[model samples]
Target: MLPRYFYNFSTFMSMFPHNYLIYGADVSIVGATALIIFVLTYFKKWKWLWDNWITTVDHKRIGIMYILAAFAMFFRGGTDGLLMRTQLALPNLHFLSAQHYDEIFTTHGTIMILFMAMPMLIGLINVAVPLQIGARDVAFPYLNAISFWTFFFGAMLFNISFVFGGSPDAGWTSYAPLSELQFDPGPGENYYLLGLQLAGIGTIATGVNFLVTILKMRAPGMTLMKMPQFTWATLITSIIIIFAFPVLTVALALLTIDRLAGAHFFTIAAGGMPMMWVNLFWIWGHPEVYIVILPAFGILSDVISTFSGKKIFGYTAMVVSLAAIAALSFTVWVHHFFTMGAGAAVNSFFGVSTMLIAIPTGVKIFNWLFTMYRGRIRFTTPMLWALAFIPTFVVGGMTGVMLAVAPADYQYHNSYFLVSHFHYVLIGGTVFGAFAGIYYWWPKMFGHKLNERLGRWHVGTFVLFFNMTFFPMYIVGLMGMTRRMYTYPSGLGWTALNLIETIGAFGQGASMMIMAVNIVRSIKFGERDVTGDIWDGRTLEWSTTSPAAEYNFSVLPQVTSVDEWWEEKKRGVVRPDHATFKPIHMPNNSGWPFLIGLSFFIAGFGLVFNWWLSAIVGALGIITFLFLRSFDYNTDHYIPVDEVKRVEAAAGR
Candidate 1:
């Protein structure tokens, strides 16, 4: 048994301190949990949630789960952002102690990037890619379930840090010397190392699965050139993930060894050099930036071309640019630390390589502009986000190029200027694109549209507040405001701008809340979309019913053009042949994924507490499940022809 101190009242209560802020969080978490339980009990939805979602192998349902999880993380990460801003709102404010602020920022960066943006984009991919390619499901459906569950468990492990022990405070990068066993001997960095290892495995598997899916599973007539641009982006992004993630996996594993086994992979006192860690990290990290943004680029392409009622102008050029960006992404890691004495030759080579990415990227921007030029445009919520992205992303890109100058980067390194620049791109790029995608695909995902009036309010306030929050950081950074500072003395002259930034952060938070409200309101009573093409979209995803049937299409679509669905729409009859109805082979939903996720969570939790016996039990559970799965040959079922015909007829397909 564990020691009595481990479960002492004071220790139990430490996670929820007796302060107003913590009390508020405690109330919110408890109240939300109670409300959910009450609603589920009232509606008798536990079985429904379990059968339909928890055990689901269906790609569309899994995608919805991913989005739900991502949004929850977004709120969590956003709360961390608010706390950091609150602390920095005034000079020398003691609202949050230094340790607390460090933990918040670390969690904020790690969650937003790893748990929030990644899952959101992956969710979009899951929902759209197979549908776009005219496949009934991804190539390996059981593996898909495993991927999501692993990711879910990984995120859960990372999130439980504060509750069990102290949160990771060495920043998301978890640099060496700082993160070594001596400087940080807690289970906090252990969470960072292990949580990411678990999640990164799933990510790598997803990459291979999608890569194989795109490579071999497309509809009969679709050639590479004929594939939808979003599918193309999915292919390239998956390749990046496949190529880039192993480096991270190795890096994390080595760091884990250093921390747990007392190895000398990155400890300063040992022969290990910390610079190797930075290099390996950025090798994966730079490509990761592209991994998140490229899908959004694909999203913007679909959104602009649809809303403008134009074939995406220069489709071939867009593909080339995407491929170019992917290739260039791997060569620019050194630019992340030009001031680290990598020498002029090394820095210059990386700097020039970094700027070269802008060339292909700029080509894409111009292509989007051309697609909208003189075309009939509908300024819907998704299109509004896209339109806003052009100018804002351009500014971010410009600043990025400025940062790429090796000599000049010495000045901007680790400053608020660097912070401002990235938010401009990432928030302006990935977040904007995510919101656009959410709005654009709401009908397809939920069978109804979100309120456009409220959507406009959401976008308007978000953009305004986003600029107010980060744009001034550039000014303050030039005035010598360094980052990672919890508080500063009153004479620093950073107070006014920090206050503006805090107000902006809260404004952004409020807009996000309004967005949540809009989703709920619309789901209860929004415009129903019987026709699947809610946006007159130019891809195969719009060819199916809203919320899509289990077998995405009754008959696989024969693709011939880049905008095959649009071409079909122009001819006005996309009716599938009723005579061709057949039984569909589908994977059976299994409870094992949830069980597997639970086992991994248990192992991760035990490892955090150094409870080796508990960890061993959980690990054995994992092995047992794997053994059971390997021998159990019955993994699939068939949807009868009659059921397919009935569903198709009801959907008016």
Candidate 2:
């Protein structure tokens, strides 16, 4: 049987004459573009932007760009969430048609996970990790530039779907039979597959890049075990990315061939098994959850220890926990579909593996608590986020454990209850952790502290409404509300809760806007940190100047302990001698990465509409650029001693 949403790939609904939603989107896009153009024209800063930012290979600058882009995607995805809320707020609400609703949610999930969360984390990593480990930059600065630009263009290609082509209506997973060309006959699914493929390529490169960086680039005497928790988190995350992302690459490639070439790899006919796609996706997907979460765990560990004025209690155990989680993450993919007739033996094995993860996780929690035990704990905004994450994430984990029970999962499968549980885990873990890191490292990134008063307000409002928004989902889900239904009839007793959820959604949106306002306000008025160690931080990053110089260190600090900088501060020691400084060799700026990203994007756009000629031209451009890069050997330049001294002196070093 054909799926409910099946349609031809070439279908384009030309009903825009009367569609308010399409018109609204069109007006918004136009207005936003006009505003951008007007601002750029008035400021005449495009040259400045291009010279410094667009082509720069600096890790810190690249990281900031990632954050900026991620926030924009967040807004886009969040709006989609609000639209869904609006539709479900009342019974039979026609705020969106069924097809439109499916597209919105699909885009929301994809954007939040791929464009928003992953980039945000990568950006933060690019910003802080090199500094934290006392490295000048990532293992491959040019490759880092390529990674960022490719991701940027990939995100743009995906975002343009609603305007230029039809939006994808399949779920973010885009399960096989439904995602096949017959059911999803549009450029939308193609965009999803290819955009992610392009972005995933960059991500895999990033994983390899950082894996080498973290492994080989630490300052002298900084052993693997003595690295900061966040660095350790990043290291593990990079490893997970390397091991797990390739599965996605292969899976997406197979699906793309299946769709475009009429291959039956995942189709029900011709020996194709749809279950293989599920297995492959979650094999990558489950670790992806950890890929995002383990970093947060690392961030939380740092926040807890810093605010409590204590060393992390289970330093060894913390490292063990992170590694264990990454290892265990791959073993539990079967739990996602225990009810798909995998039988008791298979399900039980996965169920046990899934449940076992809680041990290391619980160990991490206790370690944080023990760090806080008998210490003076400051309830700073970052610390507050760490504190809130404990119980909330614990609850999320409990619910996850609940779902892992195979027989029980059979009941909860496809229910909003599962949706609520993961949200609790994801929001509680990743979202709060990101905020904590943002607040903790704000000065390091931008040279000014975010306003404390505004930080408090933002956190309070967001946490309150976040709970308000999704907590009731558990209730409604248990009350028989199935997942992904566009509407419910008036008499199911779900109206009141759904209405409350919508109100909460609005509150969350308002809180995010306020956070944005706080960011803008802080740029000029926030506290100035001439001293880099604003938080009395314990890592290598705090050993340098705020808004660190291009060469992160004039000379690398030799680490003697886990919190080496903290130990040095306690001993009243200063920095390494700079009088004998040598010239610093750094990579020169290049525009090749930007051009290559553009070439890939053009090729992808051509492929989206099956424009063979355009695709060919774009492919040729990409090959030409690669050839040009091969012949270019003047990629490095030196900062002489005088210039290095000048920059260091200006930072009060």
Candidate 3:
């Protein structure tokens, strides 16, 4: 008690073993202060955020949230891509260390697949599926809310790994030996396992949600045969997600037990078989690619039809091919590791399946071509991306077939060529389709059109850069350049191509920046389009209001054919008569989903620091939030029938 300040310092010092406890206390105090400030700022306004944004189970809002998360993660992953690209831009650069490169790639792949592409696809599906199917909302709105929050939480956990401790560096696949505890003595791998486990739950839930909605909630007049092609793609994608994601969950769980508790599922020293992990991972991984690209295929089908002013050609054949591809995707996982000595029979079987996929995929290409063959085509930005897909995907597919030759794979496996092969398809197939879908649907989602001039600039820059960046990797792979090396010797004749690739990376980055600017400008002052039939859209979505309402269709649409809305326009079926007035019940907003997300953030920190107390507190926070939210039984209410009638009347005008 010699001095009051000295006493305070002593107390703080006593709380920590060394200086370690100081950061913890400081964080705790800051968090406590922030909580107080949050409460004070919203003293009486808590209801506003809750009612307006949080708990409203509107599909469009949910979709926006998913897309928002995806975009945020995209930049984060892209920066990682640039880092990796720069690292390999020259021989023996040593610009970044091996450990850093490992984490960069691991985070990039994990985030790109789980956070970027998956959510982008899901967001588009959420916004478009209900409208396309003529339904008011998803079949289970509460489940939809839960799924979105769960995904948000998983992303939060993954990001938190960067701040506290480390992120997984075991590549996105997290193969064994490297993934084992003895090899990776840090929290990174654990973060990956836990984060993905959480995300897997959300992904599986989403699959179930869409499946039930598509199968059971179609409008009274709609039948399977008359379903839009996008819905068919969604159906197959969901089936694959539901079945495949669970396998991933199991694999992650096994890995977690092995890492945390020494259970020996993948450790050779513990009588475990590492190949089991490989098998389980590929079981999920192969289908996971289809899970992404299939929906893109569907988007292309619909967009090409709309812009071409024609119905999708050979619709039945397209559907059949999708089903076949989905079936075949599951059987081709072994092909990924053909060079790993899986034996001639195993390799031969997977090679055939791998090559077999091209047939259905080729059929889809022909169908798209025929759809655009005789019809008048508009060169909209979305159509531009679709057209770009033709050559880009074909190149990737050709490399894929080349790799399918098991002997050739022996030469290409783990080489830069294989890397080029996947980037071609993954980027050309999934990334291009996502961009096209955004351009196609932006009017309906945002009530304004993206700047067409800027859009063209972006497409032109990105296409040229993307090909320039990846095309040479094929040459490098053929010249015996292996992948995953942090540095390479200069005399391998890989220098010129690598430098060219780096320049391409910069071009792609600049193009992305242009897109970001375009979106921001569009939201502020871009020209708005009033034509409900933007692009003379053939799907039900175009029939709804621009920037679709929270309840979607006020009166559920009746689908009389596959291109129901298109057919309606042709027949001059301008409006469905409003029989009577009824209140539209909608989900009320609640803060608990966000509260749940915040708790996961805290729990992730706790796990990273080995703080048992913080973990307990976080768990309590999550449980309390969920429990309080469950007591909210305010799901059903009515949208006034008069209100609905008036809105429809105005829409007719």
* Candidate numbers sorted by lDDT from highest down: 1, 2, 3
lDDT (Cα, tens digit) per residue for candidate 2, span 1-653? 12312232234344222467777888899999999988988999788888899999999999999989989999999999999999999999898999989989899989999998898889889988999898999999999999998999989999888776767788888888888887888788988988898899889989998999999999999999889899999999999999999999999999888886789888898888888999999999999999889888989988898889888998999999899999999999999889789888999999999999999999998999999999789988899889889988998899999999999898888888998898888888888888898888889899999888888888888889988888999899889998889999999899999998999999999999888988999998989888898988888898898889999999888888988888999999676566978999999888999999999999888777666665777899889998999999999999999998898888877
Reference-based lDDT, residue 22, model 2:
71
Q: What are the RMSDs of all candidates, in order?
A: 2.0, 3.3, 5.3
Candidate 1 — which pairs collide?
none
For all candidates, the clash counts are 0, 2, 9
Which residue pairs come into collision in candidate 2? 9-185, 9-186
Compute each candidate's TM-score over C-alphas: 0.97, 0.97, 0.91
RMSD of 1: 2.0
Q: What tens digits encode model 3's per-residue C-alpha lDDT throughout 412-506?
A: 99999998999999899999998999888888888888899999999999999999999999998899888888888998799999999989988
For model 1 the TM-score comes to 0.97
Model 3 lDDT, residue 51, Cα: 74
Worst 10 residues of 3 by lDDT: 13-22
